[model samples]
Target: AIRCTPPDALRALTRRQVDTAELYYIRGDVEKACELAAAAWPEPAGAEPPVRRRALALYTHTLLYTQGPAAAQKLVDDTLAQAADDPWLRSLALAFAADFNSAGDRPYARRIAVEAIKICDELGDRADPIAAAVAPMALAEIDMFGGRGLDRSLIERARAAQSGQSWIPFIDRAEVHLGLSAKHVDDLGTSQAILTRTLRQAQDVGESSAMLILQAHLAYTELLSGRPEAARAALAAFDAAAREAGPGIGEPGSLTVSRALLAIMDDDLDRAEAILLAALERLPPIPIVRVVMDTPLGAIALLRGDVERAITLLAGVLEQARAVHVNEPSVRGRPEGDLGQALVTAGRLTEAAGVADELAEIGARLERPTLTGIALRVRGLIATARGELDEAEKLLGAAAQAHAASPMPVERGRSLLALGQVQRRRKAKTEARRTLQEALDCFTAHGHRPLARLAEAELARGQRAGAGSVLTASEQRVADLVADGFTNREVAARLSMSVRTVESHVASVFRKLQVRSRTELAARFKQ
Candidate 1:
């Protein structure tokens, strides 16, 4: 007769601890699983090397999900060292290695992940399909951040692996991960539906640990949908779940990060900054977590008009973002656009032009017209600044069409204003006058008063142009300063006008003289 033994006693006779830990994990009994996994060590150390390797792989895997990659960093190397001949174990080791490196060194992290996938591909269906299935999830994690295309087939394969299995291995994580991916890809409905289902399942199983993760995700989804109160409610649930479950995967720190994001959306930059800084201090440097916290912090610096600080924050963020480009491809556009615009705001148009060129390439590759249009608009503005009117006109006209398709009125208006500025610079006063007027109207309709005021100034410049037209006394003074070889900055200081206003006046002076640059205006008047 078979004797019924406790799980730990059964562990001595078989690989039961590791096996049961796997069940506990899949069922979302996270703390219980982790404890059992940690005990799987000491190990069935008396077991054959392969069994020991499997135990180590399972233990490290549990740590990775629960405590973040940094928490598992040391174990990755130890597991691989001991499991050298087992391709499945080594592949798992490599995946955790990638996750660990994701925080600070992206390129290195990707190399490790590629090697892991390679091993899995070679071992596909031969060693362990369960292990093979995880490779794609690893790739998806990397690809999602880089704005690279995330092949849904990878996710589909992961989901398929759980079928016909009574235990529903890997915690049915594919659904939740896919839900997270949807959030990245701007498919909020799919995300919500999938996550809500996962949440219900976790609830049915009484897996409060998984509930914390699912709730945090739900909060993020609500935040993206612009339902802040719903997001807050979800976060509150996540916090409550964490309190109950003892900080499972994506807990405590993820809660803090979510709160910071909500504060940012509410325009409470100070609170966002404080929360982010504290989280960064306390949390493990997981790549996804780091980027989530930093992106908004940088944006806040930009919004505060701390141009240098914004550049410092955003430029570093963008650099790391590119290096780790495969993490979340769907969520990359806004940060890229923000950095480019911050450069423009700082009057770093030359640098902004380079950034715009890269963004345009990325946008085109992604086939995302909105990002493409924004990139084109930035390029057009840069060309206008450089006196490249023909190129500016082409870029801005294309941008306007793209933004109209996007239905983003403010962006379209900005493009129109840029096109008008180009026309004004090219001395096409009739076209410039009409175009500038249209831009003013667009900006006014959008409640973007500052840009509207800029558009108005452009219109005033067009109206004050020509020998036959009556000049505003202010226009007359700006025109004389430009004709006397003063740069827009100098004219701005002399006339108490903003530099942008001075640019408009100077463009008017050029149109009135039928000249191009300030040099041309100086030459014409001197001659």
Candidate 2:
């Protein structure tokens, strides 16, 4: 379906029935698409390079969705053997085949995609859209996996060939839609619409495997939109469809992971945890599984007040995610947010602030509203811990607004609670009380008892009976400066206080904050 002539236009040519079939296939008509392809060159025994490669591409794609990676790999290997001179086909086969594997294998997929891109770049725009599509799909996956470097140009160029409309472009476009939806929770409606349309088109064409994959994503998007019931329904539909399609319809680890995620959303923590552990047992080693599973597990644990356990798991997963470059635009920024919470629990305020900054950057780049809100909430916590009450209040308020705009239930609840805590600390008693009550309502609505209890505590804090306020304004200011990597002399010079006075303030701030060492003080700032 590369940027070639339309099927009808190509039908006018005497020996291009295969081309016409390819056109139909690219447009989402897999059966008719395959038929056209078969009719174009009745036999591959004595076919030329174009017909052989075309047939191999069609058959390979068919096997991928219907059989499994092994079958598809055989076809790909045979095609490569036959088309040894063609780097383009080889690249496509390599990348497309890797899609059936884990995210740990993403680097392999990315490599193939890059190879395709390199070939295309060398060939110039004269290259067909068929070859062009592979590069962008690869880049998108790479960006989604790595959490950085989304090449919009590659995506746009790959889709430039409407005349050669085929299932590949549609599949690639659907992938983009899912990726964008996962990354950006701000506009759930638009993203969901795109996924819906893509799934429909894939189904209409007998692309059952593609349809199943899209269905999983659709369910994920629904869950992200704060509709766990809808997500459950969608997952059921996907499971049913996959089962009807028989074995090999769904990839090995994919459906399993989706089910686990759904379980987490349902608050079936035991089931969710078991599912993840089982997945780890069966699936190939991959950073995505660890990162994805740990984030939710940590969230669930945190909600359950298993703070120390949550911190340990999340911190470990965050390191794994970073090791594998999992912060990409398509994967969502949940890992960083999860890690920030872990840091907060451990009272590593400065570290948590850095993680929050990372989350903010990820959200902005990916257009993710929910993630941005969570990052803002964490920033508010960091600010409050550092005694910047006004800034903390402002950030917390922004978090509330951002959460309100998205459909992520957990994030919304957390934002509300964090905002309430900041407001209470700022001495806005009535507002704090109201906000904490609202947060409690949200947590209760979601059936999150632990979070509801925490919110209640914040509400009580708004009317606290503390015997003393330990850190004075000057001391807090000096603490903030020191935590920001400023020396005592620098803090004194900037604040117009003597070095000795600055040191005295720092010591008092440390005692009042119940921390020891500059590292601990820095950690508080991050929280």
Error of 1 at 347 (Å): 2.0
**What is every candidate's alpha-carbon RMSD to the true fold?**
8.7, 11.2
- What's the distance in Å from true for residue 416, model 1? 8.7
Per-residue CA lDDT of model 1 for 202-228, tens digit only, reads 877776656777787788777655466
lDDT of 2 at 208: 62
* lDDT for each candidate structure: 0.66, 0.63
lDDT of 2: 0.63
TM-score of 1: 0.68
Off by over 4 Å in 1: 1-16, 19-32, 42-57, 65-73, 95-124, 144-147, 168-172, 186-189, 225-233, 243-258, 285-290, 323-333, 383-527
